[model samples]
Target: MGGSEKHAGLNNTKLTERLETAFPLLFASIGCIYLSVKIFNPHLKNKTKACIVIPTVDDLILFASHRAQIAQYRELEITVAGLAEASLFTSQKFYLNQNSHINKNLYTTVISFGDTKWNTQQKSKTSLRKYKINDERATHNYSIITKILKPRYKIVKETRNQKGKIKNPEYSYISIPISKELFCDNLTNGKPFYTDFYKLAVPNRDKSGKLKYRIKFEQKELNEMIEKINFDYEAEKIFIKACHTAWKHRLGKLGSDSKKPGASSFDKLVARDFERLRVALSKSKNFESFRETITDFWSRAGRIQELTDGWEKVMILLEPENWKRGRDLALLALVSYKPKNEKEETALKKLEFDDTKGEEDE
Candidate 1:
């Protein structure tokens, strides 16, 4: 009996030891599962709510064109935050308006102006100096978005180089992960073809080939290009539109005339009168025919030809009737490619000089 009692005690001790060893592992496994669920839950939710980040007005237009791509997904909600004024001109504005199928109930929130790289630098009083601390406004802006937006998704590229150079002197492409914050006590200033959000969100590549995001406007270059042009861009755009309108009217009139229904023998005899009227009208000095002829002539002209060729083409399209097309085309083409400055001559030489294959190869 004594030996049996000792054996029973030993068995109980072994059972207790085994249970104690198993308890920690069991608790650890449960904790891991809990953490996994927390992480994955947000990811699953994001599959439904898409976040969109546009840095400029131009990008907003691009987003509009692609609005249809995401329209079908029922759970999709886009969060658009960028240079606010630019966004107003883009597709987001249109979507926010009545024309789109996007859900209106989805929330829209505004971020402050100083938060944007463009605005921060623009607001800064200091002239940009290399290797100096970035404009305080710019750094402050970055902190604001990082704190307020709390976006699970990110589409921006850091502005600083690996060596800490502020390449564009505006924009921050680099990113750091953040959660909802008391955050920093200090204020800060701060094009791929793929259809998927991931691919579409990829920003324009920089000279070094890394992705970059920021507004880099060469206002001087654009102004020079426009100044050198003899004619106005606005006028040219209007003229092209006018040509299209005239062409449309011509097609409509001709098509309607051709679609007359069956009629009497007398009607057939009288059709010659209609034919004569049509022929006279066709031969008249109409805008459509003029546009066609001018464009056709220009089309056959060599690609190496300058804006003068394009102008001449427009003239050919409009001319031979009233000569109006010819005059307009010539006037428009006159200043199209005029060099803006003496420096432009050197630039052109570099651009037009292609040195890849030598004369020996030729």
Candidate 2:
């Protein structure tokens, strides 16, 4: 269906480190903090907080094999991202030609991996197996989703690496995002939308062949059923780790280590980050002082935003001059915005005039 590709709450990595460290900080003081925000923030007010994660190796396996389960949840649009994985092999020209025949959306994207110093390390014996690249199923699915959603596929590797033992966490890092409109309305020729996934009540007949009043469904009602979530920097990492852990948990729960998504795995992921951060300082003996606050941030990953918005907020709270500047910058987001039409422009001008007058009076 042709509509919109509204994406939000995206956090992807494009970072570098000069020296090797055991653990990475959100704002690694080791190297000057390379903080950049590009068209992403999960701060949509008065909406439910939830992440719509799609990429994970195990998920790709189930998605490819479990045709029945997929059909069961077809209405949820959870599998719309599956389209990304499936289209990996097709060519853009082939997709265009094929879609011309059927009313389907498809696009071909070539698979290529650019080698960076960080993601690769020299080893004496072992084949240069990529660290984050999982089984073939996962690799395939990742290709598909990245093509469709267009999220930043981040892989920040250390500037230097161990000669024999290269740390390969890059393969584990998959920043998953899929288009919302790609999963929503006009799909399947108005068959069923994500808004129609859960049935509140199945229509029933009262012992007669007559009919009962039908409760009509409205597409607008699904607006609040959001796809993205609001999370601070610390929370973002913790959230991603939690999701991966849940998926790796035994889906069957049949064996000891069989994986599935659930609350138990979520708890373990949080606890793991807590202890890891405490020991993260041990990466470098001298940097302990700098790592302390960041360690505390991860310890209370659940309450990061509740405590502070970003590092800027943390600095503002600790200083006087910074606080004044922070207040001025806060007003910038309020005062700076583009209006779509003259009606909005006039309203904005009046508000600006009133704001200027109030500021002068102050």
Give all candidates' CA lDDT scores.
0.29, 0.27
For the record, the alpha-carbon RMSD of candidate 1 to the native fold, in angstroms, is 26.8
Off by over 4 Å in 1: 1-49, 52-232, 261-362
1-362: candidate 1 lDDT, tens digit per residue: 12333356444553233667667545432221000000111223222122122222223454445544444333212222222211221223333334333322222222221122343322111111111112333222323333333323334554777899876554332221211111111111111000011111112344564433211121233223333322323334334433333333333343445456753332232233323322223333456654555454334333323343354533333435534433343222221223344533333223211122121110
Evaluated with lDDT, which candidate comes out highest? 1
Q: Write the per-residue lDDT of candidate 2 for residues 38-137, one digit (tens) a residue.
A: 1111222112112121222223333344433333442223222222222321211122222233113322221212223342421111111112211233
Per-candidate TM-score against the hidden true structure: 0.17, 0.17
- For candidate 2, the per-residue lDDT at 164 reads 52
Candidate 1 overall lDDT versus native: 0.29
